[model samples]
Target chain A: MEIYLLILLIFMIIGSIIAIEAKSLLSSVISVGVVGFSLSIAFLMLGAPDIAITQVVVEVLILVILIRATITMDNTAIEGGGGTFPFVVSLVFFGLFLVFSFFAVQEIPKFGEPLMRVSERYLRTSAEETGATNVVTGILLDFRGYDTVGEATVLFTAIVGAFGILRRRGRKKKTEEDAEKVGILEDEDIKKDFEGF
Target chain B: MPDIDEEIRDTSKGMTSIVKTVVRFALGIIVIFGAYIVLYGHLTPGGGFAGGVILACGYIVLTLAFGRQIALRKMNNKAASILDTSGVLAFLAIGLLGYTGGYFFLNFLGRGKMFDLVSAGTIPLCNIAIGLKVTASLFAIFLALSIFGRFISSLVDEDE
Candidate 1:
C-alpha cells in the first residue's frame, strides 16, 4: 500500500512538473489531467471509491473544458523559459512544499485507525434512521443535510453566475451572423434560456 | 496557419463518422449506467453528484461527437435551466415536507426493508433531486463555456 502510494505520488509530482514546464496551454492542461487521474487512483487505493469516482468525472469535465478553452482561444503568447531568479524562486517554493508535506504526513492518523469519536454513532444509527446502506450517502443527505442544501445552493449560484457572464452583452447585431457562420445554436434558445434566473 | 473558414467548417461538423458511430454505440450504455448510479445511490457507493456528473458527461460526449447544434436542440440550455431550478426546488420542497414530522428534512416516510430499491425514504428522492440539479447545472455550464469560447474566437477574428 505504501509502495503504491509512493509511486502514485511520484507520478503526480512528475505530471505537475511537466505541466509547469510545458510551453503550450494544451499540453499543460493534459499534464495536469494526469495528476488528477493519478490522484483518483490514489483515492481508490485508499478505499474511498466514492471520492475516486467523483474525482475521475470532475477531472474529465475539467479536461474537456480546458482543452476546449485552449482550442477556441488565440494562443499566440507562448511562455518564455524562466531566468535564474524565477527558477530559484520556484525551486525554493518546491522545497518548501516538500518539507511541508513531509511534516503533514507525520500529522496524519495511521491507516485503519480513524478518529471515530463522531462517526461511530453516525455509522451505527445511520442505516436505521436514514435507511441508507451506504453510510456516506446517509450522512451527506440526512445527518448533514444542511451541507447538502448549501452544496445545492452553491451549485445553483455557480451556474447562475456562469449564465450571467455568458448572457448577451450588447452583441445583438453580430449574434445572428456569428451563429450562422459557426452553425451555432439558435440565439432564441439562448435568449430565453435565462428565464429561470 | 489554416484559413479560419476552412478550420471552422471542419470542426463545426464534429468528428469523423467513425468516432460518431462509436459514440452512438456507447451513448445509450453511458446514460443507463449514469441512471443506475443515481437510482442505486443509496445501495451503492455513488450518489447524486457523481451520477449527475456522469449523466452530464454523457450529453457532453454527444455534443463533442455530433457538434453543438443537434445536441442543444435535443435539450437546450432553456430546458437545462428549468431542470436545474426544479431540482433545487424539489429538494427544498422535500425538506419542507419534513415539517410534518417536526423537523427540517426529517425522514418522515417509511424506512422499508434494507437493500430494497424503495427503502431509503426521502434519501432516494434527495438523490434524484440532486442528480437532476447536478446534471443540468454541469451541462448548462459546458454549453455556456463552449459558446463563450466561440464568441471570444469570433471577437478575435473581428479584431484581426
Candidate 2:
C-alpha cells in the first residue's frame, strides 16, 4: 500500500510539472486533471472515500469550465515558453517547500497512531449522541455545524460576486453601445432609463 | 452557399447523434445514482456535496450533448438562482429549529432506529438541503462562467 501511494505521489508530481510546463492551454488543463485524479486516488488509499468522491467531481467541473473558457480563444496565443526568472524562482520555492515538508512529516504521528484528543472523543461518543453511523458526517453536521454554515455562506458570497461582476460587465457593454447611438431617440430613451435607475 | 451555412451551424452546436444518444442514456443513470448518494449519505461514503456535484455533471452532460441553449432553457438562470436561495434558506431554517432544543443545529427530530432509511433525523434533512444548494450553486456557476466566455468570444468575433 505504501509503495502504491509513493508511486501515485510521484505520478502526481510529474503531472503537475507537465501541466505547468505544457504550452497549449488544453493540454495543460488535461494534465492538471491527471494530477487531480492521482490525488483523488491517494485520498482513497488513505481511507477517505468521501473526500475522494468530492475531489473527482470537483476536478471534472474544473476541467469542464477550463475547456469552455479556452474553447474560443486562439490556441497559438496560449502557447508561451517558460522564462528563466520564473524557472529560478519556482526552483527556489520548490527547495524551500521540500525542506519544510520534510520537517513537517517528522512532526506527524506515526502511522496507525491515534494522535488528537478531539478525534478520540468524537469516535467514542459520536454514534451514541448523533445517531449517525458515519462519524465524519456526524462531526461535520452536528459537532461542527456552525463551521459548515460558514462554509455555505462563503459559497453563497462567491456566487453572488461572480453574478454581480458578470452582470455589471454585460450592462456596461449595452450602455456603451447605446452611447454610440447617441443621436437616436431610442438610444436617448435607453440612456434616460439607465440614468433614472 | 445556404446548404454550407446550415451545415456549419449544425456542426458548431453539438457532437454527432451517437454521442448525443449515449449521453442521453447515461444522464438518467448518473442522476439516479447521485440522488441515491444524497439520500443514503448518512450511511454511505458519499454525501451531499459529492451527490450535488454529480447532479451538476448531469446538466453539464446535457449542455455538451444538446447545446447550451436547450440546457439553459430547461433550467434557466432565474430558476437556478431561486433554487439556490431556497436550498440555503431551508438549511438555515432547519438549523434554527434546533434552537428550540436549547442549541443551534441540534438534532431535534426523532432519530429513528439505527441503519434504517429514516434514521438519523436531522442529518438526512440537512443532507437533502445541502444537496439541493450545491447542485443549484454549481450549475449556476457553470452557467455564468460559460455565458461570460461566450460573451467575450462573441465580442471578439464582432471586432473581427
Cα deviation of A70 in candidate 1 (Å)? 1.7
DockQ score of the complex predicted as candidate 1 = 0.51
lDDT string, candidate 1, A46-148, tens digits: 9888899899999998898777778766763476776999889989999999999999988988877988888999988998888889889999988988889
Q: Residue A89's C-alpha lDDT in candidate 1?
A: 94
TM-score of chain B in each prediction: 0.86, 0.86
Model 2 per-residue lDDT at B30 = 93
Q: Assess each prediction's global lDDT (C-alpha) against the native.
A: 0.86, 0.82
Candidate 2 interface RMSD after superposing interface residues:
1.8
Residue lDDT tens for model 2, B98-137:
9898999999988788778788879989889889999999
| lDDT by residue (tens digit), candidate 2, A1-197 | 99999999999999998987777877888999999999999999999998999999999988887776766666534545779998899899999999999999999899768687898899899888888787778888888888888888898899888788765365454555565677565756776768845
Write the residue-wise lDDT of candidate 1 on B116-135 in tens digits.
99998899999999999999
True contacts kept of each: 0.73, 0.55
The C-alpha stretches of model 1 lying farther than 4 A from their native spots are A83-112, A170-197, B1-12, B151-160
